[model samples]
Each structure stands twice: as C-alpha cells, then as structure tokens.
Target: MLRLHRLFAVFLLLAAALAAPAHAGKPYQYYAVGDPTDVVLPQPKKTSLVLMGGGPDVDAAFAWLIQKGGGGNFVVIRSRGTDAYNPYIYAMGGARSVETLVIPSREAANDPFVIERIRNAEELFIAGGDQSDYINFWQGTPVQAAIQELAGRRIPIGGTSAGLALMGRFGFAALNGSITSEAALADPFDKRMTLERGFLLLPELGSVITDAHFDTRDRLGRLVAFIARIVNDGWAGMARGIGVDVETALLVEDGKGTRVGAGSVTFLQSVGLPQVCQPKQPLTYLNLQGQRMSGGGSFDLRNWAGYGGATLPFTVSAEAGVLLTR
Candidate 1:
C-alpha cells in the first residue's frame, strides 16, 4: 500500500508538469516536498539575503539561509522551472517542508492564492530564470506587495542568476536580452542594456546594481558601464556594482557581506560621472574603486571597504567604441 501511494504521488507530479502550459498564462504552478502541511514555526527572525551567481547550488549558502530562515517552511519561487529545488533544499534538513511556486505571468502574479503561498514562506528563494518575467509579472503587483511584507517580517530571502540580477535596488532588467561587456562598453545605452530601478528596493543595497556569472561571463566592463548609467541617470550620487562569479554567493546581513562557495565576489564603486558616456559611442569611466574577495572574506557594506579582500582600483576608457583598459 505504501509503495502504491509513493508511485501514485510520482505519477501525479509527472502529470502536473505535463499539464502545465508553456510561458506566461493564467493560473500558476506549485510543487512541494516533505510534509504536506504548511508549518509556521514561531521564532525570532532577522533578514538576510544570498546573492548567488548562476551555476551549481551553493550548499553552505543555502544552509545559512535555512539557519537564518528559522528552520521552518522553505519556499522556492520561480517564473519557470520544476520542483527540483524542493527536494534539493529539503534534503538539507532544518526546514519543515520545501515548496516551489511557479508563477509565470502578470495575471498569475495577481492571484490571491499565489500571493498567500508567498506570504506563508519562512525562507524564500527565487530560482534562476528570466528576470524580465519577474519584473513584468510581479513588479507593482500584489505579488510584490506580498514579498515586501515577507521582507518586512525579516525572513531569509535569496536569488541566483536572473534571481540575483533583480536582487539589487537597481539592476539590469534584461528586458531586451543580455548585454555583453564588450557591447556595453561600446555603447552603454545599447538596446540590450535595458536597466531598471525599484525591483526588490532592498534599502541595504541602496544605489546598487548586481551582475551574475561575473568571471565566467566576463561581465566587469558591462557592470562598470552600468554604473556609469546609474550615475548619469541621477539615480544616486554614488553607485555600487556587485558582481558574483559562477558558483559564488554573497551572504549579506547586518550591514556586512561575506563570501561563500567558489570564486570571488567583486565590488566596484563609482562616485563621479563618466567622462564620456553617450548613446552611439564608446565609454570613458575613470578611477573606479574595486575589491575582490574569495571564500571566508567579509566586506563592510557600510564603509565600502573591509577586511579580507584585495583592493583593486581600476579605470576604463573606450576609443570610438573600442574598450581600452588600464
């Protein structure tokens, strides 16, 4: 009888995945692992965010999230993907159950039940997919409101890749697809460089934009170009760009950011306007303060400099759409 029940459950899961529509559509998808009932564990909470680069899951970082999450209901939310994370995160223990919410459209983002599922989360992880779906579907909707409330409650929240992209207060929306470092340096206003503000609106990440697959994708030049746009657009007097390498994660809390997993986390800051940044032309940005930290290093988010990382101040310039480095 137990074997029959297990087989039936697997059948149902396969059926659901098969039944789900492709892309944006009415109704949302949900999958769960472990205990069937939602458990709201009562415990003191403190907010922490994990900025994960696109790659293999960071075990230590997720463990930290589960720890900070109060060992309660862990929820994974994504615009696409399957229940893969559910079992993956659940196997890590500490959480009562792991659930995945597949919210695919603006209409589904407004669904009361969907919003409620999000509201009940103790720890929320935004899985990798297209950031545009999150922006177009959830931004300014009740879904956003629900997430804001969860953050207000000081729950552990995280994201990776497209998930990590929108974690910043200001970020590249990727609405027009991804812009390369070379293309961005050539023309900061390239159509592919579609940047936007006020997605997560994490005050802790004030005047900041984040990029993923940093080293793997060679995104530094583009991130610098992004800084130029943010400063030029009057978003803030000073702008910060955080680029996390593949398999790396930044565990942030209490005004401090610590590196975990593989590779290094890059921190770049721009305080002055670009000497030459305009549409249809190359870029000229100078003296950007940068720092690179490997595993176990910590950064002082408040002071913009901290122990355990290498300081790397650099400059970038372009001649007729040709990027030149110093």
Candidate 2:
C-alpha cells in the first residue's frame, strides 16, 4: 500500500510538470534584420501604420488613418473583453463603416481569422481596456505573432489606454491595478504585477517602454517602478520610460524616430544606479536619466545613446508637464 501511494504521488508530479510547459515561456521566432536600432518601414504594397489615442477621439484617429490611405482597405480589431461599451463601434465612428472584430474573452484572442486579419491587415488597432487582459490573453499566442508580423511588415498598429500600453516593445501588463499618482507615490512596487516580453516587434524601441495617461494619472511613480524592474533584472543596461498623457499619442515612424501628437510624451531615463533593491523601499541609489525634449523634439533611434547624459533621480512626484499640445 505504501509503495502504491508513492507511485501515485510520483505520477501526479510528472503530470504537473507536463502541464507547466503549456503555459511556460515558449520561444517566439521572428524575422531578423541587421542593426538592432534600425526601423523597417513597410513596403508600399503592404499597409500604412497609424497608432491612435483611446478617448472620444479614437474614432477620429481611425477615420484619419483610413482617409490617409486614399481608399485602401483596412481592418480593425477590438481587444476589449467586455461588450458593455465599445469605443471602436459606438463611441468611435466604426459603427457603420468598418467591421469591428470584438474579442469579448481571452480565449477569443486565438481565433484563426483574427490572427489572419492582423497578419494581412493594412491597419491594425488594439482597442482600450484593462491592459492586463491583453497580457494574460494575447501574449505568446497566435494573436501576438500576427501583431509581430504586421509590425515586421511595417503596418500601422495602434491602441488606446490598454491598447496603447501594447505599443512599446516592452509593455506593462497592468496586472496590478492602474498605477495612479497616489499609489505610485505611496509605493512604486504594487502587487499582482508581471511584465510582458517581446510584444512589440521593433528593436529600436527595445529598452524603451511606455505608459499612458502619464501626468493626468500621476504615473511617474509607476513609470519609475517599471524602470527599476528593468534595471534590477539586468534585462537591459539602460532603459527609457515614456509616459504619454491622455488624449496624446506618439507615432513611431519605422523606428527611425517618434512624432508627438495631441498631448505630450515624457521620456524618463535612468542613469547609473546600483542593481540591488531593498525590500519595500522606493528604489534608491539611482540617478534620473533626465527628460527628453518636451514636444516636437525628436531623436534618431540609432543614436539613442546620445541622450544618455540626462538621467534624473527617481522621484515619486516629479512635475514635468506636457511639452506639446494640439
């Protein structure tokens, strides 16, 4: 009886191990190009790229992108899991014109037609929602691969709020609650958090991550937390934290550079800092990398190293307003 019990336990352990790989970090293969900093523009035969803001104006952004195409066909995907309120359809003008592919659940993110649409899309847009839903549902699935393929083809991929969060090479999963100014100032490190790796297909934007509703939401503390995580993990020696204000968008052109729109984009760079972190303390012993030019200031992705001298010490309440306004 004892031997039989032990055998059962061993079998259970093996079964558990086998189950783990299904959810493990399976490697994603991508097409390679020379120069990590180089941005690849989509061929003219491909699709046009347009990343829009998530707000009352989201539809306007979409319409603008579609009109910009001069009658080219396009497809839009709504990643928001709930059908309660669809900005793409009702709020946005997408109600009658474009067919909105609504993935109301995480499981729907794997639909073959959805993935195929993304792969062949002239324009792909991720609608706003809780970004954590995106990380949990789409990360490492065929949907993610299709987005990567569209990006590689240089097609415009855009999102708002949660959707906007997915724009960066490294996107905050937002598994933790929304990082508000109060929470961020109180504690940079929040619980229920995990980072999504390799969601965006651009290498130039690697080591540079983004957050939305920056100043309005007081996301400085959260952005600081994100930077600290990157440094602590040694994933990249230096990283830039880009906080985009609500109603604002940053159009990244083939990774060659970024164009600011609507609100403003804040770039936070962390200079020299010890890799070690004490438990429960705002990441200390670090230098602030300094802010990027407010608005209309552009930097070559290849020459990002030139902006390294501007690190600032991480602060919970640093006041840097939007540099550009529409």
Candidate 3:
C-alpha cells in the first residue's frame, strides 16, 4: 500500500507539470491556453486596434477585438508577465488558439520561432508590462520587423497600459521609471519622460502619443507635457495626445475611434507651442485644444473631431507647475 501511494503521488506531480504552461526560460518562454496545435481558422479578418487603460479589463473591447480577429489564432507578446492572458483570452471564444510569449531579452525577441508566430497570428496583443522592455528587447530586431509585417497585412492589434503606450507613432518608453503628472508638469523635459519615434510605424497614428489610466492616475498633465515636448523637440509642427480612462479602451477601426467601458477618452493637442518650455522650468502652454468622449458615438481620428452629441470640448493650459482650464 505504501508503494502504491508513492506511485500515485508521482502520477499527480507529472499531471501538474504537464498542465502547466509550456516553455521555460532557456531563451524565451511561452504558454498555450487553448488548442496546442497551430490553427488557421477560415474567418474574415479585419484590421483594428485597441488601446486599453490600466485597470480592470474591458469585456466589450476584448469581444470586439476577438470579432475583428475573425476567430483565428491569437498571439500575445509581453516581456515581464506570465501566461495569465492565455486562458483569459482563450475563453473569450473567438480565437481558435491563444498563446502567450514572455520574451525578456533581445535574443528571445529575435528568436525565429517567436517571429514566425507573430507573423502568422491573425490577431496579436501586447500585454501590459514595462514599455522599456518592449523597446529594448524588440526594437530593431526581427520581432519588430515581423510585427510591422503583420501590421502591413492589417491584422488586429491590441494592448493595455504600457502596451497601449506604444501603439501611437510616438511612444513614451518609460526607460527611467514612471513620472507623475506633477513631476512632468513641473519640468517638461524631465529625464524620466523618455519618448521615442520610429519604433513602430503606424501611419494612421502619426505624431500621436498615448497615455493609459488617464482618469484614475490623473495623467492629463503628463499627456499635455508630452505634446509640449514633442513640439519642443521639433518632431512635428503639431503634437497629439490620447488619454484613455481606467477600465476603458479606445477602439480604432479604420480612421475612427469608438470608446468602450464606463470611462471617457480624452484627446488633446498643443495650441501651437509652449510659451516657456525650457528645461528645469514648469510648462506654460497657453491653450490645449481638447475633447472628452464617453462610451457612445465615434470620434474621428483623422480630423480629431467627434460626430455625435456625446462629445465635450474644453481648453487647458499650464502655468508654472499648475494646470489650469477655461
């Protein structure tokens, strides 16, 4: 009886190991939540994007993403997270398979297997993690090239929090750690406000910077500061910023954006240039043309205007370290 009990214990351990996520840290790691075999389901794929704020997940936005993917293979890429997204995404039912790849280094990001999975994915998601990791590991590598290729094919792409930060043409890399709205407004050129361009080319999002957890984190001042710095850096004549509220997402299809969840999405642009945007000084931007949108109606990303009555327009400015509005 003792030998039989020991044998049962070993069987249970083997079962637990097999049930765990596959692949562990040789170079990279991956966990499959649904069907293990690769599959290409015959469904009409559509090109779309989701920028989710950091907080609770938005169910409607995810359902829309799955619908856009056309019930095909879904691949999620991240640098610091585990396979937590796999089972969550797989159970959503539009994807035939859900795979999560935890790529922590440049070598892992450039792995041929990793690149191939991204290239073939019908829908790809970037999980919330440190944006700097994504930049350092994936930038200039075959992984980046593969993602650009997938974008060229117009497949669905989505990200939340740090993931959403990089969807715009201009991304806040967050290399030096996070900077609060107070810190950013106090000094527009704060060293922690590291923004990068050409990392990922989404022409539709040209000259745009995205901020997540907008309402909950009070990130409006930071977003405004980011735009001020963009014009200060001469990247573009005009800079645009998108701030998504917590527990909400901005779904971009074609050139229009549809807000999802309970919170609002704020869009802002520099009036022209900051009056006093020098280093070690507070930003003094005269006017920031802005619009706030709720869960209804479509906001045009092309003209940066709203169609229905669900939009509210406001103007904001910063003087010294304080943000003011009229």
Candidate 4:
C-alpha cells in the first residue's frame, strides 16, 4: 500500500508538471548582442511609449526609443519571433547592450529571474506576434504585473504589430479568434469582435483602444465598431480608438503623440452612444471624429486635439457603410 501511494504521488506530480504552459518546462533563453557596457543615468525620467503599426520598422521612432533608454540596457520581450532584434536594437537603439527574452508561457512569466531582467532594463520592447498568445499567457500573471510596474516607474516601452495591440487600456484580444473588417461590419457583436479590458491602465491611454495594420488591412471599419462598443458598454462615455498603418509609428511622450514612418495614424473618437450596436445586428454610428496624422504631425493626447493635422468627421452605418471625411 505504501509503495502504491508513493507511485500515485509521483504520477500526480508528473501530471501537474505537464499541465504547465509549454514554456514552463523549457528554460528561458536570453540572447545578448553588441557591447555589454552600462549606460548610466543620474535620475529616472518620465515614461514614454512607442506604438508601432505593423510593417517595416521606423528608424525615427527607434532612434527616439534609444535616446530614452539613455544609450544602454535595452530589452526585448516576445512570445514568438527570433533574436534578430538583439542586433537591431543594439545598433538602432544605441544601447550598450541589447537582450531578447522569449517568454512563451504564464509559468515563464512568473519566473523571478525573468521579472528581474524586465525590471532592470532601461528600455523594453515587445516584439510582434499573435496578441492572443500574449493575452492567454501573460494576462493576470506576474508577467503582466511586471510590465505594469515598468510603466509605473516611467520606463520606456515599445511594441510592433501584436505588441502594439496590447498597449491600450482596452484591447481586441482576439479571444474568439481574429475577425475581418467585412465580418465585423456585418455584425457588430459577432463572436470574432472580442473586446477585453483592465489589462493595461496607462494614463491618457486608459480610454483608448488600439488596432494595427490599419489602412493596409482596412481595419478602420472595425475600429469604429470597437469605439461604439466602448461607449455602448459603458467602458467610457467617450472612447478613443487609434489605428496605425503599416510601417508607421505613433510615439507617445510627455502627454503628446506623434506619427512617423511611411503611413498615417488615424484617431477615432466616439461622440456619443451608438445608434445600433447589438449582438447579431449591424452597427450604426453617427458623428465619429477621425484625424489622419502623418510624419512630422503631432497631437495632444491629454487635450484630444490635433496640432499638425486636421480632425475630420466620419459617419458609418450598416446600410451605406462608407468611411467619409467631413
């Protein structure tokens, strides 16, 4: 009986171990590139964020990130992607050292050693991948807490593609799986239009939701739907949805956001409640404001005003479904 009980205990342990995330059993690898010197700062500065739309990276935004890092100790966090960023960050980020951490699971996210690296970095970058993996593995875990702590400390953080999707207070999450513009427009509350909240509560970004590969993917229609949901669901009386085009970057710093790279960044603000936003029914929204910002243009996030560009009015509905500027 004693032997049988011992065997049962061992089986239980094995099962528990197997049930852990895929990366739990595997070790986290840190790839280092370039000079491993320290770029020291006399004092910590306010936090800055670099939100990149999917596509080729922008050099101007990367240069800004490098400057914010104080020229050293840059870190890249990702669930999927190669260590190719190590060299790129080391060079473009102007860092004394660049390291990449591939954290693929919640268990890995809880690892104290991994958290230590995140906390020590002067600048942190989240790489592109499926944001769903990020939501499933990182949400409510120590990993999420650690990133939030970084933000609280005013550390600079940046991401591209899937990385950008996770920056806003409200995220699409893709929990029900990725949705297309046509599909989302057809039914505002389709299973695919999964929205999530409370993952990030960054100031000025708390009332904002983000979408990537905007123009290239024709995601404006869906982004409008997301804003309507935010208002209709009471997440915020007024919600902000930011859509970034391919190869573009929106740099948020000192309460201001600027657009750079080859494409434009569109800002969509819901004026009031949706005319129609029910499950299985088409969406109808009126008087939505949009601003198309290109490189060299800036906007005040705190005031929700545009300086270098114009904010145009757009009206979207189920029947006509046309994206117009007034």
Q: Could you arrange the candidates by lDDT from highest to lowest?
A: 3, 1, 4, 2
Decreasing TM-score order of the candidates: 3, 1, 4, 2
In terms of TM-score, which candidate is stronger, 1 or 2?
1
TM-score of each: 0.89, 0.68, 0.94, 0.87
Residue 104, model 1: lDDT of: 85
Model 3: CA > 4 A from native: 1-9, 39-46
Instruction: Report the alpha-carbon TM-score of model 3 versus the true structure.
Output: 0.94
Give the lDDT of residue 289 in candidate 4.
75
Q: Pick out the ten consecutive residues of candidate 3 with the lowest summed lDDT.
A: 38-47
Best by TM-score: 3
Candidate 3 to native Cα RMSD, angstroms: 1.9
Question: lDDT by residue for model 4 over 24-55, one digit each (tens)?
Answer: 44556566777645555533566689989988
Off by over 4 Å in 1: 1-26, 42-45, 309-326
The local lDDT score (0 to 100) that residue 122 gets in candidate 2 is: 50
Q: If both were scored by TM-score, which would come out higher, candidate 2 or candidate 4?
A: 4
- What's the TM for model 1? 0.89
Tell me how far candidate 2 lies from the true structure as C-alpha RMSD in angstroms: 14.3
Please report, in order, the local distance difference test score of every candidate based on alpha carbons. Answer: 0.83, 0.55, 0.85, 0.80
